[model samples]
Structure formats: C-alpha cells, structure tokens
Target chain A: MTAQPDHPDAKAGHTLISVDAMGGDEGPAAVVAGCALSAQANPDIGFILHGPQEQLDPLIAKHRELAGRCDVHHATEVVTMDDKPSQVVRTGKNTSMWSAIESVRSGEAAVAVSCGNTGALMAMSMIRLRKLPGVNRPAIAVLYPSSNPQGFNVMLDVGADVRADADDLLRFALMGTSYARNGMDLQRPRVGLLNVGTEEHKGRTELKEAYDLIRAQGESTGFDFVGFVEGGDISGNRADVIVTDGFTGNVAIKTGEGTASMIGNRLREAFKYSPLSRLASLLAYTSLRRLSKKIDPRRVNGGVFLGLNGTVVKSHGSADATGISAAIKLAAQLSENKFNDKLAARVAATLPAEESPS
Target chain B: MTAQPDHPDAKAGHTLISVDAMGGDEGPAAVVAGCALSAQANPDIGFILHGPQEQLDPLIAKHRELAGRCDVHHATEVVTMDDKPSQVVRTGKNTSMWSAIESVRSGEAAVAVSCGNTGALMAMSMIRLRKLPGVNRPAIAVLYPSSNPQGFNVMLDVGADVRADADDLLRFALMGTSYARNGMDLQRPRVGLLNVGTEEHKGRTELKEAYDLIRAQGESTGFDFVGFVEGGDISGNRADVIVTDGFTGNVAIKTGEGTASMIGNRLREAFKYSPLSRLASLLAYTSLRRLSKKIDPRRVNGGVFLGLNGTVVKSHGSADATGISAAIKLAAQLSENKFNDKLAARVAATLPAEESPS
Candidate 1:
C-alpha cells in the first residue's frame, strides 16, 4: 500500500514495503541502515523487516530513524547466496526471502525488496505470488544507463526465464513497454527487439517471428516498435525499451556494466598518472564527480519482477547502504504507481491475440 | 609467397593479404589509404585490392606508398551493406566481397581483409573457405580490450551465425582458446562460458551442457576452463577468453562497445562543461589521450573468422586509415604466426569427440 503518492492522480494506499533483512552479501546491518535512510526521507514509509529477531532487532535499534517505522517479522532461517533455487524453494518456507514475499502475498505489504541471490529470489517470488493470468514467463526488468533524456533504457528479461520463444518475446515486449510507461514514465515508449543486427532478415528464427509480432502490436499496444535493434542500441538513443530473452538481456546488461566499471577505473588511473595530471584533476574535480555520479551503479540498483501477481524488487546481492536505498526507492515508486496492477492488465490485454505455446 | 616471419620458428607463408576495396561505408579511398599505411609499415605487406577496375585504379595510384604493393582485381559488382547475406551467398560471385574471398580460396592471398559488412563477409568467408572438417558452426572471434596483462580478451561467435548448440559452443571454446594462443600469444588461456550467472545451475540448458563439455576438454585442450562467466566477466580479469553463441556474443560485444562509446562521449562532455574543466582538460591532455587510446574502438578493429579453412579478418566497415591499419596489422600477425593452419589443426583434434552434430 502506497500512502503518499508522488502523482496527484495515483490511488492512495499504505506506503509500507516488505524487506528481507538477511541474505544480502553485506548482511542485515546494511539493510537496516538503508531502511532507516528510507524512513527518514519519507515519514509515510515503513518496512516489515524479515530476519532472525536477535540479528535484526539490535541493528534497527541503533538507527534512531527506524525507531517506530520498522516491524520485525521473525524468520528464523536465511537463504545463503549460493543456495540452489530448487533447493531453496522446497526447504525455504521459513527463510527470510520467503517470509518477505509472504507479507506481499498476504496483502500486508505492497512490495518486497531483497538482496538475496537472483535465482532463489525469483523461485521464492514466483511460488508465493504466482504468475499473472496468461503470462507465460515472468521477466526481470532493469534500468540501464543510456543516452536517453531520461538517462536510462529499460531491458528485460535480465534473468527470469532464460529461454523465450516468439510469443514469450511478444509478451516481454508488451510488459517492457508498459514498464517504460508506468515505471520510467515514458509515454508511448519506443520498443526494440534486441538482435545481432538491425536487419529484418538477420538473427534466429524466433527473433524474426518476434519482430513481426512486436511490429504488429505497435499501433494497438500504444508503443512504436523500432524493429530489430542491435546490442549497441541497448545504450544508444535508438529505443527506450529493449526486449529479448532473459539469457541475452542478462549478458548485455552485465557486459555494459563491466565496460563502464573498467572505464571508470581507467579514468581514475589517467588522473593519477602524473603530478600535473593529478593537479589538473583537482581543477576538473567538480565535473569528474558529476560524471561519476551520473554513471554510478548504486543510482540504478533495482530489478523489478514483472508479470507476477505482486511487485518484487531484487537488489544486488553485494549492495551496500546506498545501493539498497536506491532499490527501496524504486520499489516504493512502483508500488505507489500500482505498477503490478497495470503490468498485469497490459499482459492480459495482449494475450488474446497470442496462441499460448505453453 | 612466403614473407618475413615474426617468429623464427613459425612456418613461412605468403603475407599478401587480399583486400576488398569496396562495399565499406567509407568507400574505396579509405581502403587504399589503409593499404598504403600497411605497406608503409611492412615491406612484406601487399594487397590484392578488389573493386571496379576504374574506381580502385586511381585510388591505388594516388597513394605513392601503394605504387608497387597494390594489385587491383577487376570486379564490376559490389555487395551493398543492405544486401541480404542469403542473397549474396547465392548471387554474389562477381561482387567485390565475393572476389576477395575467392583470392583466399585460390591461395593467391595468404589472408583476406574486408571493410565490407560483417554478415555478408562472414557468409562469403564460410561459403568460399568452407567450414573445417568436423566443425558444424564457424565463428567470428574478436579481441576485446580487457584487464589482462595482454590488454585484451578473446570473445568468439560475435555474429557468425545466430545460434550455437552445446557442441558448437564447445567448438567455440576450442577455437577461442586457439585464438588466444596464436592471435594474442597466450600459451594457456583461461576460457569462460558466458551465461546469465556464474552458477552452474543457472542459465539455459545448453549452457550447462556446454560447461561440462568445455571443462572436460580443458586438460587436453591446454586452456583453463573457468566455469560459467557472466557479462561482467567479459571485460573483467576472471578469464582470458569468453565463448558464447553468436546471438549472445554479438549482443555482449556490441553492448560493451556501445557503453564504452557512451562513456567516452560523456567524458568529453564532462570536460567541456565549464571553462575551468576545459582548461584542466588541456593540462591533462596527454594523460587523457593515453586513456583514450587505451580504450579506442579503432585500435582493436578486426574480427577474425574462425572454424574456416583459411583465416579471414573482417575490418570494421566504417574504418578510417588508422582503423584499417589496425585490421591489416592483425591480419599480417595471424598470417606471420601461421594461425590458420594451427586453428584448423585445433578444430580437427576436437571433432573426434563431438559425434558430428551437423
């Protein structure tokens, strides 16, 4: 439930978000700190923190900002980063990840935020929340820093289901465009199906099929299908939304992040190479800091679970306080907008035309 | 046809690299200029330039350095970048791209360098040179700048074919390692299979099967298989070689390039933001140039066609003189090392195990 809606037209609801306090690589302390930061910023914001009471209670107590805003849900078990998804799903009923999602399922919380492993988190979320009707494969959508005026492009499935056929890809396109509109607020978003080439005849068979399917829905779905975008276009200004199977999307995003990180490190090394260069760096300090902040990974930290019955934001497992807070901000924004409700409607609206392969 | 060998023990072979002086976005002048630069640096380098006789003749004659080194091959037809690969392979025999590959097929040129489109070039290379025995899918391998001491990592199947099966992935692994050895001079390269996640249980089924197949061959193949690697690992120092199907590999490499390009633009923008920052940029010019040169896309300009009977280097279609020179440098180096002969042997050695999935 989102209490304070950013949009005047958004329906009023509670602003409390469910969060898994354990399972993050930085542990419960970072999560508590992030929650406190969120609580301090929005007086309406609250969190149902799930973890062992002993571990989370003291962490919350130290953060005075979280004094009355945190509700400790006693989940005695924890899902380790290395736990297998299948293993966790069967035996993880009492795990913090499961309990966090349970709050969303039981309608006690509007959204669930976790820094646990992606596979396990998805496994737990899907089982607890279930897929929206007519949704074949749920997808994980993440915002990528790009050349857009909005400063980022939406890409999915980062890793929900690795394989997506023609129909599934069409569904991804529908869901992704809806996300660009509701989440990023890009009205009439231009969507592109990711491929090796921009040519219609290139790529695999399913891609060609998906190309037609996506193009056919361009007018009716209320988004322009910028047919067949290449990998460079993922960050290029060609399209606002890039839709692909989970496997390719996941690799593209990671590769982009890696390149940015390496360049960032190299940028610092260049400034430190000589005394004059370091002195010049001091002069250019403000501009460089702005550039760094513009590209910082923490500023764009959440991966939204789409086509699900409830909203779940999977933060990076190694996220520190800043990254966790960024994720919480995204979760709250989506919850406040009733993003899941709209995403489900968008998918259901497109399903009647598709012959469900599943 | 034998020219000077960079390695004394390397088998002697002709260093005459065939050139397709047409179909590039920049046209024939750039191709002739690139050849002139290559000829200027290496007395052993000669070009069998292919294009319409009238168009290429004047361009070659204008370049004084190309006077004796350039041989213009007459071809009335050209392969436009927009021409479909399927159509080219059938009706493109007279096209400059096809004629260039023909030189390699006839052993008139030790290797061929093309500034033509990638899909057409790969199609021409595969059809003219043909896949090596026991190889089902031929791959394109490119050297990507990375955190390694060698300064680059080899990633394959960038876009040769859109799909690769488990066995084809194993071939890519073998071809990639062989590429690292001969192309980059890494004796025992650490290879990784790109996936959505590093976990063995993660990714599509084909990837899991590829993990085992590649791991099994690591001992005999002389490269360390570093299990499953994510998109970030493509640039990270976790491995020396990254292998995947053309679909994922293409997206990964393009995404990386796009990101690097975006950051490069942003870096320029950041420095130009204010008068002080611009003045600081002048003070730090040399250091910034070094960083720019380190990450410049032009320096690493060639994409090698692997799993073929003869070695082929596909130059970037938009390559200028400097970029073209880099592609020629790579082509000359591969020929000097007798890389194609070794690559053929490497694939031949692995086929006994694949059961000929083709």
Candidate 2:
C-alpha cells in the first residue's frame, strides 16, 4: 500500500527524511499537509511517511508536490502519548515511531522527524541508533529565539534525563556547541552553564564541578566558556549556548513559554478594551504582526536530539501544518549540514578517554 | 548620637519594624524615603532605623511623619552586598544588618526588614532569632503576582538553601500555608508541591515522598493539597501556595521575572515602531498603563523569611521608595496579624516529635 514516487525528477539529488505520521494530535492529514508545504519550499526534500498506508496515501495525494516526493511505509501500531517509556520499550517494536527511526538506521533516510511522545521517541532512538561513542547521555537541544546576534541561542538537556552529573553536563556543552555551529552556523558559540546565580559559590555541588570541567575543555572544544549565567541570560545575548540539567532546563523552557503566551493574551485584551483601542489596534496592525512573527513559537518548533548516531527532530505533538513544516525544514537543514558526524567528532575530541561513557 | 523620637505620640499603640537602612544599591536615602512613604500611608507604623545617625538624621528630617516615627540606632559598620554569609557571621557582629535583627531579637520590634545581601540576611536572622522548634531549615517565602483570587500566590524557598529533603519540603508546605493564612488573610489556602510534572510518578525522588507527606496532612494542616504542579502553574490560579526546594524555586522565579521584563521591553519597542503606532500608543495609553501597573514588580517586592522565630522581610536591593514602602507594609501587616506566632504554632503542630530540630 506504499505511495511510491512515480516521477524520476523527484529523485534527483533529493535527501529523504523519515517522519512518524501516526501519533501526532493532528493526525496524518496535518502531517501530509506539512510535508506538502515543506516539499513546495524545498524541491530536493523527500519523506518516508510511516503510518497506516491507506490513511496517509489519500492525504498525500491531495498535494501534487507531496505525492511526487513522499513514500508511505505501513506501520501496524501507534505509540500513544500516555504509554509509559518502560511499556513502550518492551512492546513498541512495530510502531510508527519505531519504523520512522528504522529508516534512518537502515541508511534509507538522512534524518527522522517525529511529532510523538518524547519519552518513546528518545527510547526508540537510543535503542535503534544507539548513543555516539564516548557520549554519556543524549540531550535534546532547543533553539531559543534570543536577542543575540545569531537570533537564536542553543539550550540543551531540555528533557533527556532528569539527572546529570559533572561529566554529563560537560558532554552537553560540547554537543550544544556543535549544534550551534552546525545548525545555526556559529563559528565559536559562547557556552554558559545555567545556575541560580552567576557567582562561583552558588547553586548545587554538581553545577560547580560541571563548571570546572566545562572551563577546562573550552580551548579544545573551540567554544568560548562564558562563566555562570542565570535564567535571564537564556533569552539575552550573554551566551550562544546555555547548558543545564534536564529538570531545570525543562522547567525554565516551559516557564518562558507560559510567560510569553500569558503576556501575549493580556496585550490582546488591552487592545480590545474599548472602541478607540480597537481602532488603534487596526492602525498599528502591521507593527504588531511583525512583533508577533518575531516571537512566534511556530518558527522554531524543532527540538534536535543530540549525541545520537543519527539526527532526530521532535516537533510539538499538537503543532499545526506551519509548525510541522518548520520542523521538517530544520531536519532537512541539519541533514544537509551533516550535523551528527560533526557532533560526534566534537564530542570525541573534547571528552577525555577517562571521562568517556562505558 | 541616636536620633531620639521626641514625640511621645509616635510610641502609643504603634508597631515597630527594625530596618537595616544601609547596604542596598540605592543607599540609605532611598530607605529613609521609603520609610517616610510607608509612614505617610500607615500612621501606626514606626521604625527602628539602624545606621549612622549623621547620615540618617538629615533624611529623616525631610519628612515630618518619618521624623516623628523613626528612632535611630547608631551602628558603626555596614555589611557589604558581596560579603559572604560565612564572613558576615564571623565578623559582622557590629554591622547595621546585625543591629536590625538584634532589635527583633530583643523584643523591641515585631519584625526586621533588610535590603542587604540575601545570604547575609538569612544567616544573621537564623543566628539571632534561630529556627523555630521542629523546623530544620528556614525558607524564604515570596509573593508572586498571580491570577488567583488573592491577587498573588505564595511560593517558598526562593533562595534560602538549595537542598531540601522530604521533611524540609513538608515543613515548607506548612510554613507557606501559615503565611497565606496570616499574611494574605486566606481562610484555607490550597498548597501545591512544585514538580517537573503534575503526574503522581514524576520528578525527583524527594518530591514524591514530599507529595505523600503533604497529602497525608492536608486535613490536619487546614489546607487543600493539590498534589503536583509545574512551573506554568506558579502564576496560574490552581494553588495559593507553591512549595519547592530553593534551587528550583529560585531559578523559576528569576526565569519568570526575566521573561516578563524581556517581553515588556519588546512590547514597548513594538508600540514605538512607527508614527502610527506611536499615535496608537497615545490613544491606548490608559489601558496600557493599567496593564503595566498590574504586572509591575515593585507592587509586590517583599520576600519573607519563614520558619524563624522572628519575621524578616528582604526587600529588593534596588527597590525604589514605592517598592520599599510595599515591603514595609508587608512587614507591618504580618506583625499586626501575629504571623510569627501563627507560623511557629503551625510548624510545631504539623511536625512530628522525631523530625524536630535538635
């Protein structure tokens, strides 16, 4: 029931990406629509869509560009978002997420993009692709739109594991720097260790140890080590790469998102309070639109799983076609840049033999 | 050398607050001005100002209400902002911060207010007043402006100690509940334990244990226990009191503040983008002003150090007269409500004999 690319022109110099089209909240239709949007924008991008073939084929056929590029791979199961990671690891062999990662492992695809459960995706990716040699733990690197010159800062270990020791944090720094360099095109990304305070004597004991380890590897890693940075610096231009344990990073990311949305909603209410204010909103609509675009979460919807043998981008599960397209575009860019190999080289070069994962 | 209160009427039925008028970024003049503002608002509030008499007398003289209400206590030394907690404990016996806490210790004032170094203030408060019986580590409770019916949610351990065991967290819950009851006048506040997720089986090991402990004591402690909450819930209306370890709570608070300020600055830029927007801003100026006042940090500028025998409110070091007055008002209100006695009683009642501080 596969939807094969019939046209020979679609195969010319194209890079294939495996996408899990089943588990997202928007279902296969949105996934197909997003693929169509991505294919329209990037002529050389193709997708191996993993889902129920009968369900994906009809949606894929609606868009001529997607029909010429996407090939459906029939997957029997879908990983429910509520499924435990342990449960998924034990019995999620034939799921769409697993099949999507399998495409990358089999060298049939350059990368895998998923809008599924984060825990299941990470578990399947680890078991299938395995961790890179000498990498202690894999991290989820998110591009935070910032006031930096690069327009975005790389923050890692967003939710890979709830814990990180000194060695794990150092690895995050190396991997994050590589991400900023390869993905965002920064030559020397300044790395800042996230903490409660910028003082040397503050925060947990592990943070202090991680600070020393990161400082020692700054020269070898080819990234400038800016000392400790507070939560405020995550959006500021103080650093290009912010590294923290998963718990702190995850909470901080959610906090920032919640705050932005809350402020946006309040601003809208202010503009609609009265007739004159509504008229003012009409007159200032263009500037407000520009401001909205600058902070739009859809523009940066991908979270790259670093320290893996293959690149994987996890889009928000409930993302619309615009957000999914953004994730697909990010996956395509990372694949074109050969981000995984460079990240591996960077990790192996900076991490000493003694500190390598067993 | 002390500025004696010549007016006898200032002493009648007034609540005295010991204030460290030095070591803030704005200097003693701002402190004096703030005290004057508070004095103007609350006629029954008096201050035991700790600083050099020469420097304090001139500023106190500027406001007739402040001059009549303030009694100067000459202290030869001042604790600098950069002074370590350990260093302050070792050699800061004669400093103004020490003198301010001493006033509370000697029963001359109901509570102490300081804008000095947080670590130093906490250290001095613990040493002078000591932790209440059955309380292991005292916590600093902050009032976050929220959408709750009370207009704010009480969050504890904002930057006290970075570590918290199950017992310490349980104690924080008790103290925070007491704070809301007395300080904010909530009859029965809903207490929430902050975690990375709302699920029963999420976050660190200690959080799970703390959740069970808090849940068990919900009826006895006179508050509803909302099991788990994420960072987004801090500013929401789900709970009135949010309890977490100092490290996570501190980082979360700073993260929220930073995000709000960043968005605020960007919003200002959007409104000033063009001549039309500038004109729009002019028409929508009143609504925008109301919105700004609602989120202004100054209106809620005090972080109360709970679990100590005496109450200590730490104002922002850079607080202006309005912010300082807000902090002073908080201290005065807590004194009027007998918050310290109520908090101590609450801790003594909830904590088992085995868990009591030695």
Candidate 3:
C-alpha cells in the first residue's frame, strides 16, 4: 500500500485528507457537500475522495470550489453499518472505507475521515494502519462539550475496547493528554481517571493501579495527573481530559448525549404547549439559537482513533453537511499539526519499556 | 436489637418507617419538615425518627401533624460523609444511620430511610440487616424519570459495588425486576442488560454471560428478558428495568443527571438573556413549570437497596424537604407492599440451586 512516488500531488504543499464518500446514512451527497464547505473555508486542504465515481462525480461537480481541489478514487464496494468488524477485516478490502484508510497508509493522504459504522471503521483502521510501537490497544478519543473555558474536553477509550488493564489505562492517559494539548491547545492538561467515586479507594482494582501508574508518569509526560474524577466532571471544568475504560466511557458518553436530547425535546415541547408560549418562543428564538449553537453535538462530531500509525476520524453515521464539515475540518487540523506523529512519540516516551509488547 | 413487646403502637395497623434525621446536608429540620408533609399526605403512615431528641423535639413539635404520628429514638453519633465504609461498619454502632437500620431488623419498622453518606449507610445496613440468603452482593436500585406511562424506569447496581461478575449481574437483574414490579406496580417488568452495544456479541465477556443467565430465568421469574440494551435506552420506554454492573450504572446515572442539569441551567439562562426573552419566560412560565415538575429529581429521591433481608432507602445527602418527603413516601409504599419479603422470595426461587453461595 505505497503511493506512487512519481505522482504529481506527492510534492504538493497542501495537506491531503482521504474522504470515504459512501456508507453514511446521508449518502454521497452530504460527503461531497461537506467537502465543498471545508474547501471553501480552508484553501490549503485537498481531498482524495473514495467511492463509486459515477455517484460522487455529479455531486462534486455541483460545487465549483471543491471540483478543483478534490480527486476521486473509484471504489466498487461499500461497508454496510451492520457488517461485523471481523467480517470487514477479511472481505472488505475493496470497500470505500478500506480504500480511504489505504490512502493514509500509502502516504497518499495525511489523515482519513469516515462517516460510517464505528465498529467497522475502528476494526479496519487497526488492521490497516496497525498500532504504534509499545501500544497494546488503541483508543478512540472524543471531544466532550463542557463548562471549561476551552468549551471542550477530550475523553478517550470511548469504545475501542471493552477491557483495559492498568497498563492500558496509562497508555490511554498519555494518548488523551497528547490529544488535549494538540486539539484543545492546553499546555499542561489535567488528566483525570474516571471512577465511581473520587476517593482513592473507589472503583475496580485496575483503576487503583492505573491511578498510580498515571501519577508516576505525570512529571515525565508534562500532563498533570488529578487522582480520580467522577461522571459529573466529564461535563464540568474539573479536568481537561477524562480517562476511563471503553465500557464506562462509551456508556457515559451515550447517556450524556441521550439525556441532552431528551431535555432539549422536553424544552421545545414546553415552549410550544400553547399559543402564548409559542409567541414567547418566537421572542426567545435568538437566545435559544445561541444556546443551541453552544451545545450542538454536530459541531464536535469526529471521534479520533489514537495510538495508530495514521490518524483516522470517525464522524457520526447520520451526520448532516455541518457535522461532516466539522469532521473534515478536524481531520485537516490534525493532519496539519502532525497529530499522529506527536501522539506516537508521546506514547513511546511515557509508556514503560517493560510494558512494551516484544 | 429487638423492639419492646409492650410498645403501644406495636399492634397498630399503620406501617411504621424508620428515618435517620441527623446526617443529611439539610440536617434534622428538613427531615422533620418532610415527615410532617408525608404525615399530612398519608394518614396511615407513622415514623420512628432517629436523631438527637433535643434537636428533633422542637422541630417535630412545630408540625402538629407529625408530632402526633412520629416517635423519636435518641442516637448520639452521626456518620460524616467522608467516613470509609469499612471503618463505619466496624465502629459506627451508635450513629442514627445505624439505629434506623436496626429498627428494620428488629421489626419495629417495616423499612429504613436515611439521607446520609451512601457508603456508610450501605455498610451499616449490611452489618445490621444482613444480605439475603443466596445473594452475594446487594444492589442499589434507582428510579430514573423516563417517557414511559409510569413516568420512570428502574436501574440497579448504581454504586453499590465497583465490580460484578456474571452471577452478580444475574442477581442484579432479578433484584431490579422485583423493584420495577413492586415499586412501579408493573405486573411483569421487561428487563434489559446494559451493554455498550445492542448486538449479541458486543460488550465484555461477563455481560454476555449475564445475558444468557438472565434469559434462562425469564419464565420462572415471571419477567420478560429483552436481551441487550445500550445506554440510550436507559431513559427511554424500551425497558422497565435496566440491569448493569455497578461501575457502568453509576457513571451512566451521574452523566445523565449532570447533562440534564447543564441543559436545564442553559435553558433558564437563555430565557433570562434579554427583556424580550424575560417577558417570554413570564408568558411561558406555566408550561415551563409543568415541564420542571415532570423532570425534577426530587420527585424520585429514593435509592432502594435490594437483595437484602430488610428494606433500606437512601436519600441524597443534600436533599431538601421535598426530596426527603419523596424518600419517605417511597419507604411507606415499599413497606405497605411488603417489598422486602417479595424480593427475597423472588431471589430464592429464580437463582439456581448450585449457584447459591454455601
């Protein structure tokens, strides 16, 4: 999987991001629209679009700005949302998702973005890009909208693997710290180990061991280890990065998202209950719009797969043009900053030599 | 610990609840006020208030309705919020929390209610009231407000213990099912095992094992086992009872609560942003109030400890009069239905004979 060294774009100064234009619920149109939006916002970004050329060409032609910067790579197959990870690894070689990731591996693109099934995307990324040196398990880190001055906090191992030993957790912390620094611009991110209680003696035995390991690496890694934190701190300003096992982090993130949506729906229903409240809703529309913008999940739609040789951003499966644009922007930003290289260096430096898999 | 044979109210038909009034953040005054409110609402309910007599007497005397129906039990010690569970279990015999639990053990009260440190209360309850036979761990079941017709769903193992194996999770499902049935008045509650994904092969190995165990006992336990459910279903009407390990349950519940509070605060701020919005808020005040009442955490304030020999309800430490009253009402409702005995019987009948701890 090596790019053609003689290719004209190989020496191009602009950053190239691989875009999987299929597999999402919104189809190829949204992906093309999102790429056009990103190209309009950032002139130095280029795309290696992977999908059936027949379907993607018409959509790309609609936007004048994207037509010049985007290059289509024809892929015959697509990975469905219900496909198993193991199945995808074996027979998904020709799919757009696989082709998109291949571009990164072959050095044709700096990062790859997919709005597809999370399990499938993660499995394919791991199999294709492989893990960084000394990393036993890769983690998926998401940007959580919080009350922090930065407006977002990084949380990792959201659903990469359901299990994490003490050593794995330490790896997650190092990776999460690097993401927080690069993504949120925190100089010395305060990392918190998520537990049921903040006390030293709460949670499973693995978490206790992880706490000590993380604290020991804090000085060396340049990130502050803040002992333990609880679920409330995920949305609060208590920590810039919250680390936990995949199971708990995944459940917590989804629960937070669901609860937010439920409350939002309830508020809308309350405002539209009567003619008077409906009139009031019109008056309060601007303020409500401001609040909506502040808490919109679409603004932070990408989940970065850390501990890999290449960077991969997994956007929501049902992402609209705005959500896809956010993911594309994140991918471009990470590619420009060489996030994957920095993350690998951070993991190698902080992870103990003894814990590295031989 | 035994009740006095000659007590005048021993033969009374009314259900008596033991309430620890000293340790909550709001102190005994709120507890007394809550008892008065409950007494006014339910004439057949009686309370045995456990705290310092001097402090509680004046407060109880002010509420004539409570003064007639409440009996004070003097206790000298209080369990601070920071006390360790192991330490409390070993040396917290004289605390009001301990005495309240003892009342339930001695049959002087049908159920015990405490608004104190959760760890200490759980420890004291286990030591005084003991775990039910065949139960390895007792779970704390909570009522989560949902879109169901019942207005709430049951979730269990929420911070009771940080670990749960396959057997333990099966026990949690049984206990949570009993809670939904007795507490929510469901004839046969639908039980769902919480997982990161809804697929059969997803999540940790123990959760997969639990799925099989719970499904096996569905017919005998008289509950519907709905297979695996994700975190989003926790607040929805898809399941009446959601069962999970303590760690995941604890994090999900807190995350939901935090997200709800954050959004609620944002909505309030949006309404008061400008004079037009403020006037809009005034016009929509009634609908907003109705929405607030529907989602208020105070309305579902009790966390019932299941898989135990006696019933114990834990109220939030910072609960005010309305929250305390809600806890008292839950205790009375459980006592009236003889929930503890029914739960024990259900556990014994559904649990395998060989899996019973010797």
User: Evaluated against the true chain A, what TM-score does chain A of model 2 have?
Assistant: 0.96
lDDT of 2 by residue, B1-358 (tens): 1234664224557788999999899999999999989988987788989999999999999988776678888998999878889889989989999999999999888799999999999988998898889998899999987778777899988889989999999999999999999889998999999877787867889889999999999978799998898888888888999999898788778778877887777778998999999999888888788777777878789999998889999999888888889999999999999889988887887776455443
DockQ for all models:
0.81, 0.65, 0.72
* Candidate 3 local lDDT, A210-319, one digit each (tens): 99999999987798998898888888888999999899999999888877877777889998899999998899989999998888888899999998889999998999
Best by DockQ: 1
The 10 consecutive residues of candidate 3 chain B with the worst lDDT sum are B1-10
Q: Sorted on TM-score, highest at the top, how do the candidates line up?
A: 3, 2, 1
Q: Write the per-residue lDDT of candidate 1 for residues A1-358, one digit (tens) a residue.
A: 2332223112244477999998999999999998877877776667889999999888988987776667888999999988999999999999999999998999877799999989999988888898888887889999998999999999999889889999889888888898898889999998999988887778899989888888898888899998999999988898999999988888889998999999988889999999989989999999999998888878789999988889999999989988899999888888888888898888777777343422
Q: Compare candidates 2 and 3 on lDDT and give the better one.
A: 3
**RMSD to truth, every model:** 4.0, 2.7, 3.3
- Indicate the worst ten consecutive residues by lDDT in candidate 3 chain A: A1-10
Question: What TM-score does the A-chain of candidate 3 achieve?
Answer: 0.96
Show where candidate 2 strays beyond 4 Å.
Answer: A1-4, A7-10, A353-358, B1-4, B7-10, B355-358
Please give the distance, in angstroms, between residue B20's alpha carbon in candidate 1 and its true position after superposition.
Answer: 0.7
Q: How do the residues B54-169 of candidate 1 rate in per-residue lDDT, one tens digit apiece?
A: 98888877877876666677999989989888889999989988888998899877689998878888887887888787788999998888888888989998988888999999
Which pairs of residues have clashing backbones in candidate 2?
none
Candidate 2 displacement at residue A332 in angstroms: 1.4
